[model samples]
Target: MSSIHPLSMASPYIRIAHDFHTEENMRIGPTRIVDHALHYFKEGDGVYTVGNRPTTIKAGSLFLIRPGVPFSFSASPGTRFHMYNLHFDLIEQEDSAAITFPYPKQGEPQRVPLPCCLPDEQEMPVSGLPSSVPLVETATYEQLFFRILQRFGQPNTIALLQSKSAMLELLALLLRQTENQHASSTSDGTYETHLSHAVAFIQSRLHEPISLDDIAKAAQMSKSYLLKCFRNIYRLSPIKFVMKQRIERAKCELLYTSKPIKTIAGETGFDSIHSFYHTFQREVGTSPGAYRALAHSTALQQEEPE
Candidate 1:
């Protein structure tokens, strides 16, 4: 009937680290959000508050505010400027800096600054970005922040994929933020590097018969560990991700080509036409022939509709 937030996903919407949001403020003073927020002001002046405490935001100011912490903002009377606001999640406060907030729990927003690792209810001004980030490019994060805010969420059939894509983009933005802000601490570095190897390893041989052992070897990880990593970081096992990718490719081929199902199966890497059919039905909830027909009908309906 309607759409739901993707964050409530059973295994965490993002497979890897906790997700976050980024926004470039055109003007946020007139409204409020009921989620945790990390505001990095790039330009102009605005007044913001958490509960009853007031915080002044301007270019080069950053603060982490948690959900239910009442906050409001107002642009300086004559300022023609905007600020980038980012809301992010992490594994732990120890994994980040003393200023980072790991609240929000995936779907809530704390718009007021909360003390990192502190049990206090009062607000405070903190300095420094997360360990994974650097300084000086904080402004660049403003642009990325806007992009994150733009894609937050709503409802759709593709809600899962859409939220995932948004998270991936947000990850890139955060990494860039770390770089730009010159974070005092360095990121693990290999989290993405090894992850890239894993994906490329899978992609390079998708058409052949392969096993978890082979894939893990290519990615330099143990099979068991890789499965956990894949599930945690991608919200899927390696095999599942491969299947999903193959199915997406198969959908394109089915709609755009006149090839036979057996041939398509071979091209997409199934051991037999039987396996292809089963996987397609399970993931897509429709057989290949049925899907093709439906896709064709939908296309024709669109072409002829008022």
Candidate 2:
């Protein structure tokens, strides 16, 4: 699957979060689905046929099926299958509740399909999502799936918001897995090792001046390869990550300690307090003293009995 738009770009609307079960040896559908769906098989084994292509599926198999896809499921003999099925629209629609399942079921008169019901190649943020994600050993994915189901049927607004949030996170996790899998294939096992070593070196000496040469030395790779790896894996340049870490450390010190801002700046490797103040303002949108004061005020409010 090609890379697609980020999940954060879309406002997803979940229509159904179902816990589905199949009887032993049961066969369901050869029917087309009307909306985008994610099915996570939690138990048993089965054969899922899509557009006449049959694939064996067992517990922990996760599949993404787009609208108008003809699919069917056949359970293996003597075993019942359980699946968590989530149906949603990448973009929210006003009439989402009125959309029917199976679009035009077989033998029914073929009517014009709703434009909103059919998946749009451009508008659907996850059009490039792979048909399946390997979740067999990932408990985090399983928990996120179950979290969607747990909040889906609740009547409270908090639960509804939580279900949407969980779905977004699940989509992000799937995309990350695909990207990591691609990176692993191309990097030959050096991606994680080099990244870890580089990050460790940076973190261990955050109070000292760090340069690209030092990072590359720590990673034992060329500067160009180090840049490419950092961009692909961390989505940030090494220098930017260093600045981020330093700022983060400064923020923690400002919040948790009464140390003077200049002292914190010196300890975090800034060339001077002037440079630290400028960089902190640029990165955090506030002066260090203001941030500390605001944090303290917020903390005092939180500590006050509500």
Candidate 3:
């Protein structure tokens, strides 16, 4: 699995202002929300439309509604909608002028960004948050939602902190689940499961000059079969994939460390500094020194006072 940056150590002041479990046959407007919400359906069914996408919300379903997105909920004709709902915010400090919150009424759809890693399409509509409203169904997840509902009944700091911790845990689980789903969607089940071993082997040995035979043996498949599966799944030869991984590692070293260009090249498995310079320019559209300079300047600018 790819590594995601950890959340900031700054304590996010998350408050659960309202909580309820209701079984009502009703329809809510196509209005936008100003705060993030988590809804876990326990009974009945409904249709929720977020932006332009319509999703079926049935019993055992969980929905994360991002702020500023227009959404509506309508119960099925004969069934009552019963769900546990919680509305909350990740409060920002007063001095944090760089942070902006979304207000749809003011014609701004962007909300305060959350410190998470997610794909572009999955990002919050206009908030720049790392994740969008995702719907998931699982018994274990349902139990977590139930625990949050129970915690809401106790109005105390301990309970509030507990609820916040639980919500963060849930968010992490959802993000990981979504990542796994995306990985699976890119290939067939057999290829997805088997190719993972090869990918891991390559990633782990990126500092070494690994060959196709090595990867095939690690993946427990013949070279020809491995090549076919890899091409079908990743559209790249195993060697190309290894090269890409090496480049990516080199980029990280360049941006995050003050290591010399020659040292970085050697660490990333390049045969010579000349080859590293050529490959880095070809892959990144910049020389190693230029990329490092640009990254440092950007970092410094971001750290500057407003």
TM-score of each: 0.42, 0.54, 0.46
lDDT of each: 0.53, 0.73, 0.63
lDDT of 2: 0.73
Number of clashing pairs, model 2? 0
Candidate 3: where are CA atoms >4 Å away?
Answer: 1-24, 91-137, 153-156, 187-306
Clashing pairs in 2: none
lDDT of 2 by residue, 93-145 (tens): 66666665535556865534532443223354334465655442234565576
Pick the TM-score winner: 2
Global lDDT for candidate 1? 0.53
lDDT for predicted candidate 3 compared with the true structure:
0.63
Worst lDDT run of 10 residues, candidate 2, spans 114-123
lDDT of 1 at 296: 66
Best by lDDT: 2
RMSD of each: 15.4, 11.8, 16.9
Ordered from best to worst TM-score, the candidate numbers read 2, 3, 1
How far out, in Å, is residue 24 in model 3?
Answer: 4.5
Tens digit of per-residue lDDT, candidate 3, span 3-91: 44333332443444333455567787687655666666667788877777788877656666665667788888866766666555544
Displacement of residue 100 (Cα, Å) in model 3 is 19
Two-way TM-score contest, 1 vs 3, winner: 3
